[model samples]
Target: MSSGAMSQKMTCDKSQDRHEEKVQSSCKQSPPGHMTDLGKEEVADNGRPEKKCVEEVQSLWTTEASGSVKLRIDELCPQEPITVHQMFINCVQKYGHLPALASKRKEKWEKITFSEYYRCCRMAAKSFLKLGLERFHSVAILGFNSEEWFFSAVGAVFAGGLSTGIYTTNSPEACHHVAKDSRANIIVIENQKQLDKILLIKDNLPHLKAIVQYSGSLKKKLPNLYSWEEFMRLGLDIPDKTLDDIISSQKANQCCVLIYTSGTTGAPKGVMLSHDNITWTARHASRAGDMQPAEIKQETIVSYLPLSHIAAQIYDLWTGIQWGELVYFAQPDALKGTLVNTLREATPSSHMGVPRVWEKMMEKIKLEVSRCAYLKKKLVTWAMSVSLEANLKYSKDEEKPFLFNLANSLVLEKLRAELGFSGCQKFFSGAAPIGSDTFEFFLGLNIHLYEAYGMSESSGPHFMSGPYTYRMESCGKVVPGCRCKIANVDADGSGEVCLWGRDVFMGYLNMKDKTVEAFDEEGWLCSGDLGKTDEDGFLYITGRIKELIITAGGENVPPVPIEDAVKRELPFISNAMLIGDKRKFLSMLLTIKCVINVETMEPTDDLSPEAVKFCQQLGSQATKVSDITGGKDKLLNQAIQDGIARVNSKATSNAQRIQKWIVLGKDFSVSGGELGPTMKLRRAAVLKMYHNEVETFYRELKK
Candidate 1:
């Protein structure tokens, strides 16, 4: 189909999105009788017919409206030499009047329309070209999420310079590694803090030619440094038509970005994604997720997540451009206010989040519920349950039971308004392992938070929760058109997840042997993540293969399940490491949250045994995690054993409980360069750092 045909079809689908209307209508009908079967136990146990019940609804979500619309390759002919420049042309022509990028001024969010966004990016790109930046040259972008940071990246891309994105949270040493490794010629940074990080390593990186500072407040004397405004001024000499011609000469296979992996181990490696890689990934994602152009023009996205990450890059920026979506950037400190206000002003139809964001949202709800009157909380809970049941039954068969709808209107509608999610139609959560209970509860609120699963290597999405037909535990069926397989499984069937698809990265830049090793003889890229597919072919990730702990008896144990259990039982505990290779039993090193002293109000050194002792005395708190390892001494043996008897009760014969354990006071932090930005455990480095504590666990036992 032609682009015009695709546009018309998408416009038609926008006319058909009546989910909220259906929900409002359902609120007026009677309750479904079948719902009794779904929530009977909760009603019976609570001795209240109106009590809220938590249940999972299985519904199928499809993009039949948008999916049928197709675009031939001819529709997307490159008008520019590079992807970023081409995107600017797209924004100017298609979505000129729509807000394209946003930033904050005086604690208020300000928006720049698509045309304005294009103009800024073009000016920056032209400036780079004037600076003699050439194809394959590397430019590093460092700082908070800002308009300057984004436009500079577009500028680099327009000049045929590959951008190396570095998280502002990273240390000077980390910055040095990325700069030296990518051989960046120019560094675009936000402010003093970011510039300082670069300056600290400037002597270490001799290839670095210039430091482009965005904040105009930098008045200090520095060598080869340019201000953001000064850089844009240089572009004034370059004509718009000349820059357009430069953009048109760009090739799809040309390296556009040098995205560093959130390194689970060692130094971060640059993953080279070509212009084609990004465009195709965005296209595939848009198609699979039904990210329609009309939705872009209508939806408002609040961008606060680190722009350095691929998730932010693909979902927030690239996808937004394809559809003419408005982008909103929030100040780092005012994320909560910005997110809530943006949601209110934009009343966004679509939103994407991570596990941490969802957990905080739930915590906010709990906090609000705490402040509400008892009767109001009970009414809200009851209404939500009824609404969920009605939705489930109605979805199964479009028959609305009248009684249920009346109960829903009384309570559920109010609950949604309180959550500030009343207008949100579809939500997506990805990047971390989310609790199944939390996942189901959101579904009960009439909001489907599809928990997607994938890594940077997979171009950001491999599996997703079908917006309509979602399974609580499983990440949605392998995203449409992607093929995957399990490589070398153990007896219970879990194994390394391998994938081969159009979306997969070409390979780690300049690491030929490592790239070859990642793929099998047949070319399937081994995902290093351990997982299993249910009989229905739904993929469920358990843990990383390297993070899997094996006992002396060779019984493989995925620590994530156990660690998740430990953390659930103790939210104050930030990090936990289970260690036991050839030892007598599995033991864990717990890191408890540090508390401040009354006198100084300063955190008491937590890296001491006293903190562990204090946490142990707090009591044996426990919460059950599902579909995990089942053993005889399960309940009693599960909680970290304070003594021998408790330890004996928790472990099965072969997995016999933790013999000894120690608690560390300090929590792992990414800013400290201890944990990766993604929060994955760096076991070897962790073990090496705490070698004494680990040794004490076994050494004390030997005594």
Candidate 2:
């Protein structure tokens, strides 16, 4: 079948009354002369299609259980499903000589070809098999992004086991939960620190059979613990056919990966993704993002984001493998401050950053610009205005001003090169809401940081912004072959964004109640995200259903928009969290930008360069957060009040306006439990942590 025909068949046409029936029928039918069950078609040695019994193909999607426990596989299309192993093999066959993974060792960089990567993965798989890894079991990797991490993850799947990633920052108890819940047969750690975490909880993990340390020497040798060298050698004696048979037994519909959500509100739930989910989403999403295949032009990407998150896993690992992109392993301190250094060297063709990452870059650039000579600063200011105007016009499909070229050549191009984004074709921000201030800041630099929206349950991205489909604040259109609907829409057309696609995960692992809650009767995954579609089908996320604050007057207010507005109005503010649930009026908790301790990622009292400059402009000598919070800096206090008033003046209703706010002494940090690993605001956690302060806002009102 042609690709277009397959896409049309797969896409759910919500306008038609028989759309649900069509979806059901598609899942039940077996097209003649086409592969039905196993993901992609099998080819014979003679280059013809290998035939399989229809009965065998039909059994792929079936399971012994009924009700919610049964895997949900709907909207089947004519395109055959492919396994992760098959995808890797296909890429190797086509780009075997191409660089697949690169790592810096000492002062030199080493590259591995696709063929070598596949071979190493097979070795890891054999090692897993030898270590007693069983079918449906998991190999949990706790470490930074590295070549070994990829090999272990892909190898586990090749050995008929699930690949799970434990966040490097997880505490011992949290790590124990993931390890025990997943029934991990083997735990792979990067260094002694992660090894120590596993050791502290190893007694609780009955299913854990082996532990492998991939980096650094073992602190103390113990039973069932092996070094990287020792682990790889254990599988050397295993027969290739032994591992091949296990790989062949794998099916496209079976769960192969377990992604645990970052528990912002509650305990993390393991998200189950099948072979088909990863394979299908990778192919379609790459196309949606206009990712060039290796056959066209091999792409390069620097992988630094937490691989535990679905966003990073899909973009850096699965998608990279799918397109034969060269994946460079960023240093362990990448998030601390070295990511830009890696970017400078790799000169990646594409980059993905969480909102916090982009925000930090913006602050860094702004600080440097603030210190520039008067004439240079003026030139940069003028160039930014020109580029911002041109880009805004371009987004609307309007002609760019003639001076755009001049500005790009003089200032914008150098800025991009300085930041090592000269070759970056696409810049993506996801995993959290990006403030419009940060979005516009990038636009001013001639960089279009497209926003993507999805959760672990949706594989990665259901809606994505690309060059042709982007809007100023919208998260772009639904990916091809996906279906979306806004449920329980309000008068403004905003509602819970429900999604259905090949990318939707099977179900939450061992949580039947949550799995059932995730989907409705029609098998659509309830995204739990409140959003609306524009006339052009672009999705604008208003807020999360869980995060929406209902005032005492019953007025609904989304805090993100309000908080973003306040931050935009006050350039010195680093974080603004709106609080007013069940209260008569709204208030806010604000934090000023301060110097961060790179070693510990803790906030310091010393003001950041930008903050210091802002205070200087206000004719204040305050340098520490304590200096401003002491109530002695009248200029700073008045400036903040003025900014908040300006933000309040634009409020649609009195209930939506912030009545009062307090500037917190310290900024929110992951270690402080005010933010998640992705740097997303933990509203519930924050409120609880500052319960005393929060009550003070309504103390007088209650009396």
TM-score of each: 0.77, 0.91
Q: Spell out the clash pairs found in candidate 2.
A: 39-80, 39-81, 39-82, 40-81
How well does candidate 1 match the true structure, expressed as C-alpha RMSD? Answer: 14.7
lDDT tens digits by residue: candidate 1, 99-181: 77766555555666665566667677777877777567778899877777777777788776777789877879888888887
Residue-wise C-alpha lDDT for candidate 2, range 418-453, written one tens digit per residue: 898989989999998888878989989999988898
Whole-model lDDT, model 2:
0.83
Cα deviation of 421, candidate 1, in Å: 2.4
State in Å the error of residue 561, model 2. 1.0
Task: For each candidate in the order shown, give its overall lDDT on alpha carbons.
Answer: 0.62, 0.83
* Runs with alpha carbons beyond 4 Å of true place in candidate 2: 1-77, 396-399
Error of 1 at 190 (Å): 1.0
Candidate topping TM-score? 2
* Error of model 2, residue 355, in angstroms: 0.8
